[model samples]
Target: MALTVPRLLAARAEAEPAHIAISQGADTLDLAAWQARTQAIAAGLRAAGIRPGERVGLLYGPRDWIAYACSYTGVLAAGAVAVPMSVRSAPAELAYMLEHCDARALVYGPAAKPPDVPVELCWGPERISALPEAEPIPGPRPGDAAQILYTSGTTGRPKGVVAAHANLTHGARLNPPLRALAHSRHFLHAFPIGTNAAQTMLFNALTAHAGMLATARFVPEHFARLIERHAVGTVFVVPAMAIELLRSGALERHDVSSVALFGSTAAALPPTVAAELAAAMPHATLVNYYTSTEAAPTQTSMVFHPARPAALGRAAAGGTLRVCDEAGRPCPAGVVGEVWMRGAGIPRSYLDDPETTRHVFRGGWTRMGDVGYLDAAGYLFLVDREGDVIKSGADKVSTIAVEAALHEHPEIVQAAVLGLPDPVLGMTPVAVLVATRELRLAEVRAFLAARLAGHEQPSRIVHVDELPRNAGGKVVKHRLRELFDAAPDPRT
Candidate 1:
């Protein structure tokens, strides 16, 4: 069979039908049931005219993890493409993704109202449980499009990064799974679906041979409780979740000693946070990996060095990392340059965007736009993204996206957004604006609260007579940062 995941899933069902495959809150589903439901859902899609190679959208919340997993597998089982979108995505963002991927169907959780789409299904609360179990269809081959994950790009528009079936399952099936993960009985994570992180969690659920547990929204306390109650042995969080867990002091409140492995990705783990995470999970091994939308499945390996807690480990199994200067020549140890990666199973292009794909994907390597250097030992270190993509805590806040949201208010004429160093979060987003009306930080926040996520909203806003701009008409972010630093608060 050409299916990497569905094959393992089928094996899990036949070998350990009763084993808990996934759990959320008090709800749990076993491998056999999930398999049956997945097949039934696939049949449902086929019945609805979703043919092979057609793209199907999945917009699911974490609480509905069972439905989410089933839908993901169902689309693949039918040999159709899966395009996952964030439930928190703005309507415009959803519209852009559905249109860009040319999705044929959309599946939403019960808690969320289905977006405006032609063919939609509410795979709501316990709905998958009722579907008749249909025979599983033949799965896709290695070259078939398994998924199209849309990530925010430098231009602030969503770009659909397509992955082959092999690329989708390569990272998880790597021989000699991480020690802590392999021995674990249950794995807990709070990643939102539609993210690469979430897909990794999905792979773990399918093949880790451990029950995968998740929460709807990542609040520190809720995550702590899940670990305490489930005795979760392996857990994964993005840097933002780690920061909140530390700042909230939630670890101290719960008995989380059962956790033996803690992992973070999606952003660099701050050394301070790394040290604190060590203190919090003294028994668990803390590991982080570096990857991008284009350079993924190929990633650095699990690393744990108390001496250099922030170091992203060496190239992952069957992966290679290189640091090259502007001329594309390899840089010597400790010399900064662009980080490029080639994972054996990494996909090659963005769907239908040959120009952009060709720019980043070259010679079987992905040019990760972040600046970084490799040590003599070959560990990668990141300085920053090449542009105004704000690495605010764990969230990849797009300055352009935030500015676009701010521009939605006609009161704001021109806005320049930048990142400020924060102790708790690695960075906090700050905005300096030239507005037509009196705009306060609270007003700016209130305006964006509806448009962007909480982390994307500026922690601080400053008013200026006019934003310093280069002759090319791009607002100079460094000059804007200097302006914000010089004035604690500016009044127009």
Candidate 2:
């Protein structure tokens, strides 16, 4: 029995020593070779003084998935908690994360400009495979902290969620005979390191009947080319990536019929995007998954219901979910409340933050902190984030409601809504849009006048070339507020 991911990986290496386990462009590695490299990195970390229970920082960039995989597993083998930081993060953000986690050693990719830490190792892509091979160290205990993945820090500084060895191993303990992933020879995704989506893809590779194929960065054309070149049967992407693939006209340009399953996660798929994807890939089943970094892999998956495109499906096997009112009581069907869930994959708590840990982690359940409701058929419907709700003079408006309305416009590619200071209303709604053409505030107000209530309508509108996103494709809401607020609002 596999108590951890590295142990399962080791078992696979013994069972299928020569089978190809990973492929990217021209690079490929068989199970035995991959296992040996992971073990070598593990031994290297131990020799470099990575102690058990210590937090080790990881900064592998997008170019090489192999480095991320080997180094991550190596940290577990060494029994140190891995702290994976985004390579895209600013220096200060990176510094804060390392300092907050009390990271002893920073294992970074060549491109990463890590902070001033006690110890640092620069494992360039070329050098990752050449590290001296060494014997395997002791395996991790089930209750031990395996990794620390940071959240978006929307409310405060990014919080690090600590995953136990059992939590990290949940995704790979998959049952065989999956409908979509099992039939595919290769599954393709473009998630960056330091995100659970990327980690889940790697787990799918180990558990399912596919060799994981990945791109260093997400380029729509490049993604299309890979699908055509590899005859990829299954592909998973964020909703933004799917929307890009649709907008780029790459679906029509590339012969991507080999794709049988199109999966999406990180955020709910816009109705327009979901409908277009279904029409574009008629042969494929569109799946939307819902889960957070804290309750990862143990997700709610919906097989794109034509009638309920917005519904985030039912709890996955071995997962439990419920919609609860403020008092923590389960809400009846069709009632909005907080979404709470628990699964073997759910992290134990946020590292070093007992207050936050106590706030969200109750018994074995994790409060998802999102406003949602369950449907009559037991499906979950996510309405808005509790923190993201906008308040007007006399009404509380959901940001999702405004964003959904904006998505209805053909010219609007993406939209984010937030509350702004208003003398008359105390707090008024504002919109930041990524559009194909310049949009005036009057144009937005007129378009949404009939669709939304007067108070719910965006009082200010700002246009941007692109909405900034993290590695997982979630909009960095704070950045939008900072960068777009200063833009001249046509209303003024």
Candidate 3:
């Protein structure tokens, strides 16, 4: 049988009928209820003229738990592909996606107000109840499209990456091992479900019969309470949220003893912050995984090991990774190169951009555009994005390396390093930092001088309360470049 979302839900409903499938604060839905609601919503969409292979956009906040799931599953159940957009996205961004996807219908929560679309279905418990119940329509083939995800577009316009049913299910099965998700685990999903991480969590929860809880928005205090209340076993958080939890002193006050695993993704988690988290949640296992929207979970490392702070782990199950030079030849261990991955789990290509799709995804191997190297032990260590690698003087410096060095300082909470245009050196390295306590330039320079090579160190260090980041907790380096370029040149 082809692996599909509805099929997984049906199997869970049959085997774990009474199991708590989802929880929204005081409200909870068993597997049976979840399946029924999804089917009902699917029937409503069918009745409204949504056909198989059509694209439907799901616009809802993080909280509206069941509604969002119902909308996503409903689209799939009706033989349509679901395109989930971030609630934090600006109207213009949403409009661009909607137009690009040529979405046939938009299923939005009660609170959402999308500008213009062919069809708009208001979704809520009451609205869902009013719709007629219908059986799920099986239309997706193994090779048929399952989802269309927008890349982070750190450099240029975001491209729509399409995943087939086979690719998505295979990747979903592989992710649990990478993040160590178990059947008995209870996962708290506070991040936007539109992203790849959210998709992985949803798939794993349903497949493994794990209890999933969601919050409308990420509130540090509420997250703590939910962990205690639900006995959540695992959680996926971004670096920003981790820093906020550390600063707010919220994790210290709550009984988060039930949390066994904490996973960080979307951005690099500084060793200093990881150490702080390890101190706060001493009993929990902290693992960091790295991947992008174009790819699924690629590498991961378990916390509390001697090598924990050194490198990301090996390639996930069913995936193969290589560090290759400009000519696509494999690089020796300890030498940084472009990270390339190939497996059944990797997505085929971008949705519409054939040229870019061919450029990035070549002959079943997908180029992550990230620079990293593997150790003799086969562990992958990420340095920086290929485009973001700073060329200062004659040295090629990884911004991630500089950022890691800066984050080692006691006063520095977070740091971002990027390359700025320079007439003499082609590009010069600049660093921006956020600090928990007062920090001085001399202290930062001294700290890096002890850790990084002379050429790898940033020429200028700017202090800020917080670094500008996107929804995924990745430092918006483009925005940082704008700010950095506008500042008066230090050499002048």
Model 2 stretches with alpha carbons more than 4 Å out: 120-130, 171-180, 483-492
State the C-alpha lDDT per candidate.
0.77, 0.82, 0.76
Shift in Å, residue 160, candidate 3? 0.6
Q: What tens digits encode model 2's per-residue C-alpha lDDT throughout 259-293? A: 99899998888876888899998888899999898
> TM-score for all predictions?
0.78, 0.94, 0.92
Q: What does the lDDT come to for candidate 3?
A: 0.76
Residue 303 C-alpha lDDT in model 3: 57
* lDDT minimum window of 10 residues, candidate 3: 171-180
Tens digits of per-residue lDDT, candidate 3, 345-384, equal: 5466788889988888887788988989998988888888
Off by over 4 Å in 3: 117-127, 171-180, 183-185, 297-304, 485-490
| lDDT ranking of the models | 2, 1, 3
RMSD of each: 10.0, 2.3, 2.9
